[model samples]
Target: MAQPMAELADLLTRLGTWTTLYIDGPDGSPAPERDARRTSIRDRMLRAGTPEPDVEVALELLTDDGPPAPSSQTILVRDGTVRSSWTSSTPGRGSGRRS
Candidate 1:
């Protein structure tokens, strides 16, 4: 998401839409490194000049330890309502580079 967020900043600079990030923790619970990763992403987005009001972040933590979610999704929410949500069937897509 390094250059991508920067690219997003460029695209959203002249627009009023926002970009929200959800850090879904491992096993639905917060990872030990969750803070670090969240900080990194937020900082990168800000450094890229993403407008403060145009950026949002949320961390979804689980109630108990369990396996990772079977799927990853992109969800759009506005005014506390889901506008859209889609899960990718492509394996290892959200986990990052495989090789």
Candidate 2:
């Protein structure tokens, strides 16, 4: 099972507007900007050798572009609670999760 993203999530809502997305590329420095596409995670959480898809997803979400279409968002968590959820793979189970 997946664990709730708590501390980091808190930081996102309470402090910063963006989460650093780790990508496998030339390690990009963390750039703090008003937009979510400001930086990569080379300076903070992750280094090189991470998968590209995960990085892409992080960028898309933080960048406010939404997860790639046809992709079901399983959890929209805030401070360790489920705000909203939907899954193409698993239908009608959103009631089990809650904020």
Candidate 3:
């Protein structure tokens, strides 16, 4: 737990504005549900002034092919590029913010 917190601190120390996204991927959900979520994410990112390139990259990371089991994803982007991202088996609600 300390190691993870240290890593997060390091990430926060980086210079430049950051866009962090937490998404609960639509694993067993319907196609429309997934599409709606994707659209919402895109809109939010754009509204928050995230670069188009970064938004596209983040969307790519959020993709799921209707897997039987659910999963969560976290995407970090800066200056129109994806800095880091990861997926986990735990379920999570979708959200995004810039700092």
Candidate 4:
């Protein structure tokens, strides 16, 4: 079983390498080499074992930059178990409330 902190670190490693490319945005066009580098980073993340759900959650948290909503309930995990459940305003939202 993976520790929560380790799981978070693996997820961050994937996000740190993410990139994208756009041709001739409002500002100006980027050189082909820049686009290629962006693509390479994206590819690497895709190849990594990062879950798609985790990626979506990370993007929402980072880009929205808003206060988190309250958690609706608590989760209890038994020893040696691989999964746990909790409730919140949003479905699948774990009840790891922050102080």
- lDDT-based ranking: 3, 1, 2, 4
RMSD of 4: 15.2
Which parts of model 4 have CA positions greater than 4 angstroms off? 1-30, 53-99
Question: Once superposed on the true structure, which residue ranges of model 3 sit more than 4 Å away at CA?
Answer: 1-8, 65-71, 91-99
Candidate 2 residue lDDT tens string, 1-99: 233568435544764223233222222334543233335342232365434444444434433233333333333433333343332322222455465
What lDDT, from 0 to 1, does candidate 2 have?
0.37
Q: Per-residue error at 39 for model 3, in Å? A: 1.1
- Candidate achieving the largest TM-score: 3
Query: Against the true structure, candidate 4 has what lDDT?
Result: 0.33
Query: Which window of ten consecutive residues has the lowest lDDT sum in model 3?
Result: 90-99
Clashes of each: 0, 0, 0, 0
Better of 1 and 4 by TM-score: 1
- C-alpha lDDT of all candidate models, in order: 0.44, 0.37, 0.73, 0.33
Model 4 C-alpha lDDT per residue in residues 40-66, reported as the tens digit of each score:
634554577444543333222221111
lDDT of model 1, residue 25: 25
Q: What TM-score goes with each of the models?
A: 0.38, 0.24, 0.69, 0.24
Clashing pairs in 1: none
Q: What is the lDDT of candidate 3?
A: 0.73
